[model samples]
Target: MGLIISIIIGLIAGAVAHRVLNSRGGFLGNLVVGLIGALIGGKLAEMFRLQVTGGILDQLVLATVGAILFLFLWRKIRN
Candidate 1:
């Protein structure tokens, strides 16, 4: 299902982002961040006119980048 795939992608993306950024968060946290990151990444891609094909790889990359950016900003804002 579409929803299931999205969740899986989100989890993977979040985990990857957390690993890359060396941030602390559990499964639920990663899922939340990943979903939000996907949204942010989608909007950014649209705004920038980036051609993101409907592929798992593309989505994963975008989501990971977005998650990293989100975590980075969150840390900055919190501190």
Candidate 2:
């Protein structure tokens, strides 16, 4: 159940990030980005001591922001 939820969040977050950044990574790529972003987002939230409400919407926002950051950094490094 937890894994399923994570996957759904990841897909949504990744899609949102891709849309915001105007990137064309496909479904699997977005999933990968989103999953990794979740990890990064979790760590960042911890580091910053951000308040989390334990809601799906909060998780989605965090994951989407992290995915955008990840994509931005990835592009910088790639270029």
Candidate 3:
């Protein structure tokens, strides 16, 4: 149940991040990015011992941060 919620939040966050980052991609692309972002964010949060309350907003915040970071690195690598 938590995982499902997290994934849903990740999808929304990824889509929004794609737009904010001016990323050109389709729905699946956005979903993939967002899912990866969620993993990345979750790992970082764990490492830092950041206590996320396991809610939609928390998931979105974490996913957005991760997505932004991913996009930044992606652009750098592409360039």
Candidate 4:
């Protein structure tokens, strides 16, 4: 259940990040990036003491943060 929810959130977050960053990728690629982003973002928030959880909106926000950060880093590395 949690995994399923995370996947959905990741998908949405990835899509949002792609638009924000003007990045390109297919659905599967986005999902992978999104899942990775969620992990990264979760850890980052943890270090910063951000209490995120308990709601879809909270999860989405966390995932989005992760996705954006991941995309930014990837872009920097690629360039």
- Give Cα distance to truth, residue 35, candidate 3, Å: 0.2
Worst 10 residues of 2 by lDDT: 53-62
| lDDT (CA) per prediction | 0.91, 0.91, 0.83, 0.87
Off by over 4 Å in 2: none
| Worst lDDT 10-window in candidate 1 | 35-44
TM-score of decoy 2: 0.95
lDDT of 3 by residue, 2-78 (tens): 77776677678788878988888677777888888888889989999998997778888888888878877888999
> Per-residue CA lDDT of candidate 4, range 1-79, in tens?
9888888998999999998999897899789888888888888888999876659887788888899999999889999
Clashes of 2: 0
What does the lDDT come to for candidate 1?
Answer: 0.91
Model 4 worst lDDT run, 10 consecutive residues: 50-59
After the best TM-score superposition of candidate 2, give how far the Cα of residue 6 lies from its true spot, in angstroms. 0.4
As a TM-score, model 3 comes out at 0.83
lDDT of 1 by residue, 9-61 (tens): 99998999899999888999999999988998888899999998979999988
Please name the candidate that would achieve the greatest TM-score relative to the true structure.
1
The deviation in Å at residue 2 for candidate 1 is: 0.5
Ranking by TM-score: 1, 2, 4, 3
Tens digits of lDDT, candidate 2, 30-79: 89999988888988999999999878988888899899999999999999
lDDT of 3: 0.83
